[model samples]
Target: MKSKFLAMLLAVSAISFSSCTKEDEEPPPPVEEPKVYQLPGLYIGTYTVTQLPNLAPLRYVLAIEPDGTITTEGLGSDGKTYYQQGTWTLTGTTVKATYKTINRTSNEVTQSATLTFNEKEGTLTEGTWKDLVNSDGYIDGKFGKFTRVKDNP
Candidate 1:
């Protein structure tokens, strides 16, 4: 009887100690990263820089391909003809583009813009631009408001 009690106690202790609750044994699913949703349609239109108190504004005819490649032909801040090739991506409602200018008279100019989508007018506006590549001769100021021309075709 004493041996039977000892064996039953050992078995009970083993079963109680070996088993764990599902919550403690299993971990929750890995935390997922935030999802970035791009714009629904093709982004191809005219892009213009609307503010420049010191120099002339830029007007770019932008064409964004399906593979995210971007090409533009427009006027530059230096009052010269400008052509750029770059890439763009959209995160939520904000769109960001990075491109390089082909013409470099004094220094190489790379354009990077973060723009918000205007749903009412079917346009992208209120852009924040940066010249990350050019520094020696490029002017220091905000990129100002960028407006896309209507009837983009």
Candidate 2:
């Protein structure tokens, strides 16, 4: 009778342990990684009018939005803040921007620029700034180079 009672106790303990394991334990939850923010299509940076000595290098924020909108902005120490906005298209390493620029005095000028992106130098090379409607060039065909500016990643 004692041996029979011991065997019954052992079976009961085994059943209890197995049921406790299945009911008490659960799977681990999934881990989520952090998301990173990124800039738009165009390379934004600072541009210097190499031909003009009196003007200082200004910050230029150029971006082509998802809806095919183009934006070109720059600030000068000479009090000539400019913003050029319109449509942009990219082909290979080259970008063509046909936009209108407005200065601090609200003088509007129409222009077009064909610029090639130089990845090695992190700059925009072979930039040709021209006035489409007027012979008197506002940028004066003076666009030469636009070096990339580094910012927080």
Candidate 3:
């Protein structure tokens, strides 16, 4: 009876030790970090002209690259198709886009606008695109809202 009790105690001690050893083992490998999206893709969204009287709503699809290249596609006056290629840059809260008119009889224009982004809300608020050249040219002064779309075509 003494030998049997000793064997049972040893078995119980072994089981408890093994359980503690397994618990002390390292956890599974840490999860891999997610990849960050590069800022060199097309962002398509609508832009509302908020200024009074000229409250014209426009739909625009713009492609921006990190190398300061920009391409915009949208409708223009006379109800015809319009496409323009330009250069763009982001400095702090400002975005400047300079585009040369593809069609003849149009002026080359440079527009500078302020931008405010809310990461929590995933929203972008854009100020009016002001003409850099003409002092009295059409200054939009309009505020537009845009939402980021994943896999924007």
Candidate 4:
């Protein structure tokens, strides 16, 4: 009976020492890293500018700098040389920019547009724009599109 008691005590002690709760048995799960979203580097493509009635859509190159500035130059379909200067911001997958269209010769802001880009493809996408200046052809519409042509600005 003493041997039996010793064996039972040993078994109970072994079981008690060996058993562990889930938290104590395994190292705390490795800390999970937080999720982060990265902004794109550079985008180069044509953006449409509203032209006078009967004129074709103007062709312009959109240039985004590392400092969130929009600087561009192009020949308007109406036969005017122009450039743009403005700043841009990003929210989620949307990019918003407010720029002024300046006539190269006159050096005046002829029009202004607030463009909102919402394509997440990281390659090509269409965006809508509303000209801040209420001119004849500067109405709100889906007149903006750009393709990611390069990286690192």
Clashing residue pairs for model 1: none
Candidate models: Cα lDDT each: 0.63, 0.65, 0.58, 0.59
Residue-wise C-alpha lDDT for candidate 4, range 6-125, written one tens digit per residue: 999999999887786565676778998753323334555545544344445555566777688776665656576677788877775666777887545444443343444434454435
Tens-digit lDDT track for model 2 on 10-61?
9999998888885587867878765432223555555555457677656666
Model 4 residue pairs with clashes? none
Candidate 3 local lDDT, residue 18: 88
Cα lDDT for residue 2, model 4? 100
Q: Which candidate leads the pack in lDDT?
A: 2
lDDT of 1 by residue, 1-153 (tens): 999999999999998877865756868889997543233333433344434554554455666555777776766666777888898887767878889888776668887877786644445666566667876644334333434443322
Model 4 residue 69 CA deviation (Å) reads 1.3
What's the lDDT for candidate 3? 0.58
Error (Å) of candidate 1 at residue 10 is 93
- Model 3 residue-pair collision total: 0
- The stretch of ten residues in a row with the least summed lDDT in candidate 2 is 34-43
Give residue 5's lDDT in candidate 3 (0 to 100). 100
Which rank order by TM-score, best down to worst?
A: 3, 1, 4, 2
